[model samples]
Target: MKIGVVSDTHLSDRREIRLPQELLGGLSGVELILHAGDWISPRVAEELEKLAPVEGIAGNNDGMDIVSRFGYKKIVEAAGVRIGLIHGDGYGKTTERRAFDAFEGQDVQAIVFGHSHIPYLERKAGILLFNPGSPTDKRRQLLYSYGIMEIREGEITAVHHYYASWD
Candidate 1:
C-alpha cells in the first residue's frame, strides 16, 4: 500500500481557501492518507478525503471541536503493519521522546507525528519514527515537505517529497 503522510496544514475557515498544489500533486494515487494534525479546520480533511481515505489526530492548535472529534492519538493497521499516529506536543526539545512514549508498550512498527514542522525519518529501536513536516507551513525550515510510505511484503520504505516553496 502507498500512503501519503502530511501534518500541520494550519488551514483556516476562509471559503476561498485551497491547499498547496505541490502537496496535492505529491499525494496523488496514494491508497491512504495519514494526517498528524493541527489541521485547524475540518475542511482540510474533507478536501484530502477527495484524494484518498484519511485518518488523523488533533494537534495542540486544534480547537475543541476538532480535538473532540479526532482526539490526540490513534493506532491503525494497514498492509500488515501497525502504525501509531499522534501530534507531538510539549517536551520542547525532546518532542521525539514524548512521541516514543505515546506508543510505548505497543506493538507498533511505525509512529507518525508532527508539531515542529521539520521533516524527520528515523529508525530507532526497531521502530520507524516519521514526521512528514508541514506542507503548508514550513516554519523555520528552508523547504516545504511531506512524506510517502510504501508497505509490501512485510517491509516499509519511506521518502520525503520536498518543494522549494509553495505558491
Candidate 2:
C-alpha cells in the first residue's frame, strides 16, 4: 500500500489556504493519507479526503473544534505494521525524544509526528521516526516537503518528496 504523509498545514480563517500543488500531485496514487497535524481547519482534511482517506491528529495550533474531532495522538495498523501518530508539542530541547516517548510502551514499528516544521526521517532502536515537514509553510527550510510510505507484508519504506516552490 502507498501512503501519503503531511503535517503542519497552518491554515486559518484569516488567510487563504490551499494545498500545495506539488503535494497533491505527489499523492496521486496513494491509497491512504496521514496528516501529522497543525491543520487549523477541518477543510484541510476534507480536501485531502477527496483524493484518499485521511487519518490525522490535532496539533497545538488547532482550535477546539479540531481537538474535539481528533485528539493529539493516534495509532493505526496497516500491512501488519503498527504506526503511532502524534502532533508533538511542548518538549523544549528534546522534541524527537518526547515524540518517541509518546509511543514508548506501545509496540509500534514507526512513529509519525510534526511540530518543529522541519523534515525528518530516521530509524532508531528498530523504529522509524518520520516527520513530513510543512508543505505550505517552510519556516526556515529551503524547500517544502512531505512524505511517502510504501508498506508490504511487514516491512515499510519511506521517503520525503520535496519541491522548491509550491507553484
Candidate 3:
C-alpha cells in the first residue's frame, strides 16, 4: 500500500499554503493519506479529504473539536502492517518523546509524527519513526516539505519523501 503523509500545514484564511496540484495529482494512486495536523481550518481537512481517505489528529494550533477527540497516538493498519500516527506537539519539555511515548506498549511496526517542522526518518529501539515535516511553513530553512510511505507484505518497503519550492 502507498500512503501520502503530511503535517504542519499552518494555513490561515488570509495567508495559506497550498499543496501543489502535482503533489495531490501524483497521489491519486495512493491507498491512504495521513495528516499530522496543524490544519487551521476545516477547509484544509475538507480539501485533503478530496484526495484520499485521511486519518488526522489535531495539533497545538487546532481547535477544541480536534483537540478533544483526536488521540495523541492513533493505531492503523496498512498493507497488514500495524502503523502509529501522532501529532508531536505537547506542553512538556520533552514534547516529542512525551508524545511518542504514549504508544510505548502498543503493537506498532512503524510510527509517523510531526511538529518540529523538520524531517526525520530513522529506526530506534526496534521501531521506525518518521516525521514528514511541514508542507507549508518551514523553520530553520526556507523550504517546505512532506513525506510518503510504501508498505508491502506487512513490511515497510520505503517510507520517506520531501518537497520544496525554490520560489
Candidate 4:
C-alpha cells in the first residue's frame, strides 16, 4: 500500500486559505493520507479528503474543532504494519524526542509526527520516524516537503519528497 503523509499545513497563512497546486497535485496517487497535525483549520483536511482518506491528530496550534475530530495522538494499521501518529508537541526537549516518546510501550513499526516544520525520515531502534514538514509554512527550510510510506509484505519503505514552492 502507498500512503501519503503530510503535516503542519498552516493553510490559514494565506488570506484565502486555498491549498496550493504544488501540494494538492503532488499527493495525487495514494491509497491513504496521514497528517501529523497543525492543520490550523478543518478545511485543510477537507481539501485533502478529495484525494484520499485522511487520518490525523491535533497539534498545539489546532483549535478545538480539530482536536475534537482527531485528538492528540493515534495508531493506525496499514498493510499489516502498525503506525503511530502524533503532532510532536507537549513536554519534550525536541520535537523528535517528543514524537519518539509518544508511543513508548506500544507496538508500532513507524511514528509519524510534525511540529518543528522540518522534514525527517530515519530508522532508530527498529522504528521509522517520519515528519513530512510543512508544505504551506516552510519556516527556515530551503524547500517545502512531504513524505510517502510504502508497505509491502511486512516491509516498510519511507522517503521525503521536496519541492521549491507551495504554489
| Best candidate according to lDDT | 1
Worst 10 residues of 4 by lDDT: 11-20
lDDT comparing candidate 2 with the true structure: 0.90
Residue range 103-133, candidate 2, lDDT tens digits: 9889999999999889998998999999999
Distance from true position, residue 49, model 1, in Å? Answer: 0.3
lDDT of each: 0.91, 0.90, 0.74, 0.89
The digit string of per-residue lDDT tens for model 4 on 55-92 reads 99999999999999999988999989999999998764
C-alpha positional error of residue 87 in candidate 3 after TM-score superposition, expressed in Å: 1.0
* Ten-residue stretch with the least lDDT total in model 2: 90-99
Which residue pairs collide, candidate 3?
none
Using lDDT as the yardstick, the better of models 1 and 2 is: 1
TM-scores of the models, in the order given: 0.96, 0.96, 0.85, 0.95
The clash number for model 3 is: 0
Candidate 3: C-alpha lDDT: 0.74
Give the per-residue lDDT digits (tens) of candidate 1, residues 10-114: 988975458889989999999999999999999898999999999999999999888887889999888999999999998655667788889999999999999
